[model samples]
Target: MRTILAAGALALALGASGIAFAEPVKVGMITTLSGGGAGLGVDARDGFMLAIKLSGSKDIEVVTEDDAMKPELAVQIADKMIQSDKVDVLTGIIWSNLAMAVVPNAVAQGKFYLSVNAGPSPLAGAKCDKNYFNVAYQNDNFHEAAGNYAQTEGIKKMFILAPNYPAGTDSLNGFKRYYKGELVGEVYTKLGQTDYAAEIAQIRASGADSVFFFLPGGMGIAFMKQYAQSGVGIPVMGPGFSFSQDVLAAIGDAALGAKNTASWSPDLDNPKNKEFVEAFKTEYNRLPSIYAAQAFDTGTLLAAAAAKADVKDADAFRAALAAAEFDSVRGKFKFNTNHHPIQDFYVREVVKNDEGVLTNKIVATSFTDHTDAYAAECKL
Candidate 1:
């Protein structure tokens, strides 16, 4: 367990009298930090800690652990964090399967789970809980945006593939929800798969005009590199995870001109986003990824809620969190009935920046003030 120290120019007072609380708010973060998906988890941790540091609240103490991309390990870490650490809030999970193993248990045990990423459909639908909130996005939101983009572009037959995990399955389902096109092929690869020789052969034979995939982290890096080498001429696209800042350079020109969808971008014209991007780059000496942005938003939202209500008061704190009164990096951010984000999703094309670094630029807005399809099914 590591304690993150707060240091920044921004000052935040926790109580109504503008003073720090007697007892600190304890946060437990269980995420992948040493595996194929380590990059995503590392960025999430850095971005979340950065936001907490910038909030300048000495009352927030975070204890973190590496889950190593295993469900059992994540469950063990979550139990330790909640029982031994006595954490007030649980956050910072990157994968949906791990979240499934931890969130319901943590929330049911009276710990608030402010999800930084991995908003599984079950959590957002009939099984919704008052103590669990997803500050990032629903697992399907980004893929749905990509589907809308493909529909607008008049894509006829699309070949899509994803890892055979909760998030991966949600990705393809979301795409199919909004993509008014015939599916040439749909393949489910192994989670954390590194090779694409077999998938590439299938894609080539499918004769699809375009391809969509949901391989993230090192898997994306490996797949894009192998896909490039395969010499298959089909245009490829996916959600922002595949082309995030952490993996873009590794993907190199393979991701160039590929369109992806996201809720927030570094270039988003908002004061909070501008400050966050500058602070992230200055503090970390590198650009932040979509995972980072979501985690940062989670931290900032918690800070805002902490300012209004004490973590000990469940009802007040839940109301404060649901209010979502913080300025988000993505403009016009709000929470739906299901505790998922209702915001704009944009289609961004991968392009080389003026500094010759591969990055994304918003090409079109796919959905504005969009709520997840499952929100209506949520009773809460």
Candidate 2:
């Protein structure tokens, strides 16, 4: 009896030792940082790095690449990250077109992809994969919120503006989903366009009382600056991306009172948001954009999952992340079946904070029990 018990104990000890020597977690973060889409990607990278630091993560090594907002480049970098670099998980994409390409490939490679933003529509639908998750709103979720708000504000005639691309179409469709208003015109701007004089002229010609747009990054600055000077007597509204802290600082007072909708804001009046805003300001010496907040939340959630999971293994970590319950800066974040988030969307007006930095102040939330339209696509 003593010999049998000793043999069992010895076997258990060897098994535990083998588990301890498994592997370190390798994370690949693919984003846009140097080319046409630098501004958004730079903020996302900084925010994600800051999150890694705050988590005091040592067991994980993250290697990053620049997709340059090019699909071919995205695929190339994803291949390197997956094959040569040996990443166990992937994260951080800033655009929907990029996400649509990057995420499916990552999942196909049998790796976990945690998105900080840019949830493509197809992922929420027919191509949904279990190895993926989004830490931000769907591609059209924010646009839909703006649409819903337009309906609430009694907007009758509207003109929609977006870049000529898949994301732009998604944004416009998202807006139209909730906005039961007459469409005066639907216009597409050049991607990364700065001069909005022609478009502003078109708006004046179209006679739109309410203008909805989906511009972001440097384009937002130029568009808003031009819109303010265009003498177009209309209320401009959209989601909080293109005109948040990063571009707001440059646009300054021009973006004041422009209404946008989003799931998180610095002035959300939540304990976690307040803490995040304060810490982010101190660390970066600027107001954090919603992109930064989303990246931070992604890190927090990942750390929580890793702490509770057998993270040295990929499948175990994915399961753990799916089951994670982290304290979100947005407050109470969780995943839906499609791995998209179920969160509130607030209507915020661009306002000057106490430090003279432009930020958003929440006016009203368009959704309380918001659910993305793509969950039924996912079998898991």
lDDT of each: 0.90, 0.84
- Residue lDDT tens for model 1, 185-289: 999999878889999999999999999999888889999999999999899999998889999999899889988899988888899999999999899988889
How big is the positional error of residue 12 in model 1, measured in Å on the Cα after superposition? Answer: 22
Error of 2 at 239 (Å): 1.1
- Cα deviation at 311, candidate 1, in Å, is 1.0
Per-candidate TM-score against the hidden true structure: 0.93, 0.92
Look at candidate 1 and give me any clashing residue pairs: none
Which structure among the candidates has the greatest lDDT? 1
Clashes of each: 0, 1
Model 2, span 1-380: residue lDDT tens: 99999999998888787534445677888888887678778778777777777777666678988888888888889889889998887888887877877788789878888889888888887888888888887888999999999999898899999998888888999999999989999999998888999999999999888899889888888998898898887888888886687788888787899999999888887787787778787888877888889988888787777666655566777777877588788877777888888889999998887877778999998988687877787787
